[model samples]
Structures are given as C-alpha cells and as structure tokens.
Target: MNSNKKIIITAIDQRSTVAIVFQTITIGLIMIGSAVGNIGILLAIYKTKSLQNKTSIFVANLAVADLLAGLLIMPFMFICSIIGDWPFEDASCNLTGTFALILGAAGMNTLGAIAYERYCAIVHSMVYHLKITNRLILIVITFIWLEGLVLSLCPILGWSEYIYYTNEYLCTVNWAHDVSFTYTIMVVMYFLPLGVMIFCYASIFKVARRHLRQLAMLDTLSPPSSHNQIVSDSDTQPRIENSARSLRLKRDIKAASMLFIVIGTFVLCWTLHGCTMMCLALGDTCPVDFPEYVYTMTTWIAMFNSVCNVWIYGMMNRQFRDAFRSLCCIACLRSSNTQVIQI
Candidate 1:
C-alpha cells in the first residue's frame, strides 16, 4: 500500500477506537448514576409523606429536569458519538436536539432557583412564609422552563447559529467565536447563579453559627439544678433548643454544604469545556489529536453533576438518607421474593 493509504487507514483506526471507548464510558456512568438517583429521589418522596414540603418540591423539580436530561441527552449523544455524525433524520434531529438543549438549560436554571430559595430559608427565615402556594411554585417552575426554551430554541428560530465542532460532531452555540456570546452565556448560566449560591450559602452558614452561639450562651446562663425554675419553662427551653439545633443541622447540610458541592462540580466541569471552546474560537489552535475527546469528556462531566446531585442529597440530608435506605430494603425484599419463587 502507498504511504498515503497507510496513514489514512491508521488515522481512521485510531479515531474509531477512541470514539467507541469514550462513548461507552460516558453512557455507562451517566445512565446508571442518573437512573439510580432518580429512582431513589422518587421513592423517597413517595414513601415519606413529610418530605413533600416546599424544599423537597423544588428538589423534585430539579430532579425531573436532570432525569429528562440524562434520559434524553446522553442517549442521543452516545448515538452521535458512535456513528461519527448526526444519526437521526432531519425532523428527528430537530426535535431530539432541541429537547435535549431545552432540558439541559432548564436544569441549570432550576438549580439557580433552588439556590435562591435556600438562601431565603436560611438568611431571611422571619419573612419566609412557608405559605408558598402551589400556584406560586408552579408559576416559578413554568417560568424557568420557558426561559430555557427560549434560549435553546434561538438557533432554530434563526436568532443564533448552531454549529458543531468538526472534530467532535457535537453541536453548541458557535457565536462566531465571539467572546461576547460566551461571556453573556457564562454570566447567564454560571456567574450570576454561582454568585447567588455563594452569597446565600455564606449567609446561611453565618446564621447557623450565630444561632448555635446564642444557644451555647443561653445554656451557660441558665441557673444550676438547685435554683428554683418554672418546670414548664425549663422543659420548653430544652425542646426549643433541640428543635433549633435540628433545623440548623438540616439547613447547614442542605443549603450551606450540599448546594455548594453541586455548584462547585458544575463550575469545574462546564467552565473548562466553555473556556476551551472560547480558546479555539479565538484562534488558540487547539490540538486536534485529543481536543474533541477532552471536550466530550468534560461535557459529560458536567452532565454527571446532575446525576450526582441525588447522592449528594442522600449523604447530606437525613430525610433523603432514610428514604434511600428504605428503597434499598424494598429492593432487597423483591429480589429475595424472586429467588424464592424460582426455587
């Protein structure tokens, strides 16, 4: 064979192998993590009637968006990666691609809303009316979805251009490599929400610390056991203290801790991918050998954040942990019953 033919064969062989491996790893991780997390959250809410409060409702909304993103986007991406181009017909392409983009955008926005809500619950508890009506939450959720739809559908409507990186065949907002577009999106999607999250969570932590300090102070001030004390007042104070402590722990876990982890993971994964795209657009001459693979991997990493959120919840929130344990027990019972029948 000629040298040209030999090099051509070698390149195709290499690219094909890399594509297969990347697709498999991305698909496996996203699918298993998302499915398990979604099931756990759903079962947790259903079994624990108490978990259906305002906070869990917001979480449920976020989970629904992430669940859809995982189920729709990752499979579509996996097929595209393996086929080396758009696999769907033009109509299917438009629908699937648009749906994926919309849900992905909505997921981010929902996370921002959750962050803001947590901020309010922690920092401004006196003003927080748990009377957040169903109508209000529904309106908020609908607005979030609509905002995402508008942004994602702009290219389809000709307000923007949809371009795929030739190397990876993944589509995104090309914006003609303009920093303006990238910066605008970064602000809208990342910077603004991240700022809100950081500020709110910091406030939450401060509030918790202050509350704890006050409790410790009161404990110290209370008279010794020998002192005459109103029995009911004494009993009530301990109950109040215990309840306050429980709340501080819960808020600290959900708002001040777990939420930061989610934001951190998201910023880490998407920021790199976004910066690389910006660099390539600005004529940085990205290395061709593995740029696409790196980009694809990082993109999946961002998506994986969605998958990990439920586990974060399970780890941080007592209610989520209890719900997850219950789910596992139920699964174990079903498996044992199946074996008994087979016997």
Candidate 2:
C-alpha cells in the first residue's frame, strides 16, 4: 500500500512538471510570434510605398495595438506563468489589466473601421475617394484609440476593478466585480463591433454577387465575334474604361474576402472567452462552476488572435506576401554578410 501511494504521488508530480513545461513553451512562442509578426507588418507597410494607402493606415493601427499587447501584456503574463503566481505589485496588475483592455478594445474597433472602409470602397465607389480621404482616415483612427482609452479607464476609475487571479496568474478586469460593467463592456467592445463587421461584410458580399451576375449576363448577351472585331476609337475607349473598372471591382472583392476571414477567425477565438465572462458576471443566476484553468486557457486563446492576423495577411494578400519575402531575403543577406566579415 505504501509503495502504491508513493508511485501515484510520483506520477502526479511528473505530470504536473510536464504540463508546466509545455505551457511555458507554448506561451513563449505566442509572445515571440505576436511581436515579430506585428512588427513585420508595420515594417512592410512602411517600406512598401504601394502599401501606403488609406486601407493600410487602418492595418497599421491594428498592428500597433497588437504589437503593444504583445510587448506590454504578454511578457508579464509569460513570466507569471513560469513563476505560477503574480509576482508584481497591485499597481503593476492594474497597469497590465488596463493596457490589456485598451489594446483589445482598440483592435476590435479597428476591425470595425476596416470593414466600413471596405464597404464604402466597394459599395460606394463613386464617392469613396472624396469621402474617405487620408485626413478623414487619420481622424477615424484617432477616435478609435481615444475610445479604447476611455473605456479601458472605466475599471481603473472604479466603475468595476482590475484584480489578479491566482489561478490565471495574470491581472485582468474582474468580471464578477460588477455585472453591469461587464455587460457594458460586452455591448461596447464585443457586440457593437461584431455587429458592424457582420453588416458591412454582408453588404459587400451582396454587391460582389450582383457584380458577378451582371458580368455573366453581359457575356451571355454579347456577340461571340465581339472579342475579335475591330471597333472605332470612341467604342474602344469606353471598353477600356469599363475593363479598368471591372478589374478594380474584382480587386476590392478579393481584399474584402480576406478581411472577412480575419473577422471570422477573431470571432472563433473570442467567443468562448466572451461566453465564460458573461457567465462569471451573472454569478448565481448562471450557477455554473468553471475550473480556474478554463479562465487561463480562454484568455490565452484570445491573446493568440493577435498572432494570427499577420499570418493571415501574409498568406492571403499578394502584396503583403511579396513584401514579406523581400524582407526575409534582405535579412538573410545581411546575416550572411555579417558572418563572412566575422570569419
């Protein structure tokens, strides 16, 4: 009996050690990836002049938010995860919690803004350039950051509160502190932005489909010899202009599709965390017991979304992919040159 008990205890200890090591490695990778990926995005946008456009401005803002979260929030959480406790003071906890909230709110708001931008560019192409000027885009981004700052400050201002959870080993807004505050965050941060993204994407999709159908109808009605026939200069000019417009429309649709994927991934990664928080805020009315690890895992999952956006851009956008490739090649050449000089 004594031998069996000793074996059981030893096995449990080994398992715990393995779990810790795995978690540390996973979190460390996420932190490094998030930082590197977001930085790469900002660099690509800066170095590639073609990428410096109205849409790129919003992309850069999102990158800044994710980059800050990766640097400020993830590093502390990584250390605490390794230490298995919050080793910092209460003030540090509050700071991290507030930053976490601010970055998250900023990211969601930026996504909503991007969706609206795409909607206008595609659905209202005639007025898009006149209405969505660079100056206006800058103002919109400024508003997004300010909105995030004000909402995040609410907890610090005593509307709710930030507290360190021992089980989670990180500081965040206390969902149970005030149900009303929790609901407010849900409405402002999650639901409102999500609604905007959904509505915009839906409208964009409808326009794209209508364009496709019209093109198909035109093809069906046109004479088969139209492609080969010589035409007058007057007719040729109009055809050229129409062709240019169609190409631009196609490009816009492709970009919108990629952004829709990003939004979908964000929803997938955050839904569980959002639902869990709502339940916690409900308290007795919810009456569901959640394991401490669940909280930790859900938060980590949401944080991982920051790491995904850059990858999605690199994979889906040709311009981004080319820029990334060029950057990587330059980096490799620099490393080789340095090694040769050292030798």
Clashing pairs in 2: none
TM-score of every prediction relative to native? 0.82, 0.90
- How much lDDT does each candidate structure score? 0.67, 0.80
User: What's the residue-level lDDT of 48 in candidate 2?
Assistant: 98
* lDDT (tens digit, per residue) of candidate 1 on 102-161: 776677777777877777777776676653557777888998788778877765776544
Top TM-score prediction, candidate number: 2
Window of ten residues with lowest summed lDDT in model 2: 1-10
* lDDT of model 2, residue 67: 92
Q: With candidate 2 superimposed using the best TM-score fit, by how many Å does residue 257's alpha carbon deviate from the native?
A: 1.7
